[model samples]
Target: MSTVVVTGGTGTAGRAVVNALVAAHHDVVVTSRSTSSVHGRVRTVRLDYGSPADLEAAFHGPDAVVHCATSFTGVRGGETELGRRVLAGARRVGCGHVVSISIVGIDRIPLPYYRAKLATEKLVENSGVPWTILRATQFHELVTRLLSGLTRPPLVLVPDIPVQPVAAEEVGARLAALAAARPAGRVPDLGGPEITTLPALARSYVAAIGRRRRVRAVRLFGSVFAGYHAGHHLAPGDATGTITYQDHLDAWVRTRR
Candidate 1:
């Protein structure tokens, strides 16, 4: 089995990827800022992009590296710097293949986060290491969290935008498979099983939690929201994900019971 290193292994998508790689019997090494919170049979390492030694150690001697690390809450150049360090480390270790996870419509979306993701994708393309970039739509959990936070008392205000939210586990599995295969520059974008409106998603989340909240659709006046509302962020013909939003809510409700 190939030695595979997964960055950001403690995060939602990264954790699922690590589990899948371990199940496949690949020599999997996971990295995080701290290993104290990491569980399971996988090996864990501390990763800090600011420290070149840490980056070099994390990517050392890996046949393949799955880069899932991203910092959305940090400074403006955090994501770009992280991507650079990952590529540099992979190059240092002579990694054969590098698989990266990105968002669908990052090129079309004008939001700063999407722009940063797109910039990172560009880095992988020119990193000289064989790479596969998988661009997926929003995750069901992210949508649920966003809606939950927007639920102010009795009214849940949701932006009127179309979204195709995929399951993180499904995306993780896809990433693991890609990491095992030959690098294919950019694969077909993965999307949810169905196209849904944000308001519909909010209502489903409210009903799942047994919250008596009124869902109201709001038109957000911004370039970012306009792009989303125009369906630029959706993958209509590329709905590869089988799990629907309702399925996500049902599973979540079962977990809470």
Candidate 2:
């Protein structure tokens, strides 16, 4: 079995990717801040990225590394810093293949977080390691989280923009396969099976949660929203994900029961 390491093995996307790797019979090493976040047969380790020795030691003897760790450090370059640490560790350990996950519209949108994501992507491409990068649309969980935050009691005001929210598990599965295979540069963008507007998604989320709120879609003009309005963030051409947003909601509700 190939020895593969996942950087953020406990987070939403990372957890799914770890599960996929385990199912594929790989000797998986997952990194988590808390030991309680890890389980199953895979090896779990804590990493302190600031310490070069600790990072190098964590990365030692891995066939491949799937970097699912993400920090939404807008404009400050913290996201790219995280990537730099990971790449340095991998290069030191001589890991053969490195796979990274990114967002689909980071190149098209000028939002601070998206800019940070794009910067991280550039870092991976130029890191001198055999690497593969997968840019996917937003995850269903993220969309729901955004909507939840916007819901202020009686009403939810969402952007008048379209979204394609894919399942984290599907993206993780794809990343796991990429991690095991040869490093092919940037792969096709993965997206949801359907294209939906923010207001519609918010309405569904509110209904699913049994929250009494009216959802409204308002147009907010900006370079960011313009990018969204132009559908630059969408992936209708690469809508390969199978899980629907409703499907995610149903499964989430079950967890709360």
What's the CA RMSD for each of the models?
A: 1.6, 1.5
RMSD of 2: 1.5
- Global CA lDDT computed for model 2: 0.89
Evaluated at residue 141, the lDDT of candidate 1 is 89
Candidate 2 Cα deviation (angstroms), residue 126? 1.1
Q: Clashing residue pairs, candidate 1?
A: none
How does each model score on TM-score?
0.95, 0.96
Residue 89, candidate 2: alpha-carbon lDDT:
92
Which segments of model 1 are wrong by more than 4 Å? 36-41, 73-76
Clashes of each: 0, 0
Which numbered prediction scores highest in lDDT against the true structure?
A: 2
Per-residue error (Å), model 2, residue 220: 0.6
**For candidate 2, lDDT tens digit of each residue in 151-216?**
866867788999999999999999999998999999999999999899998888888888899888
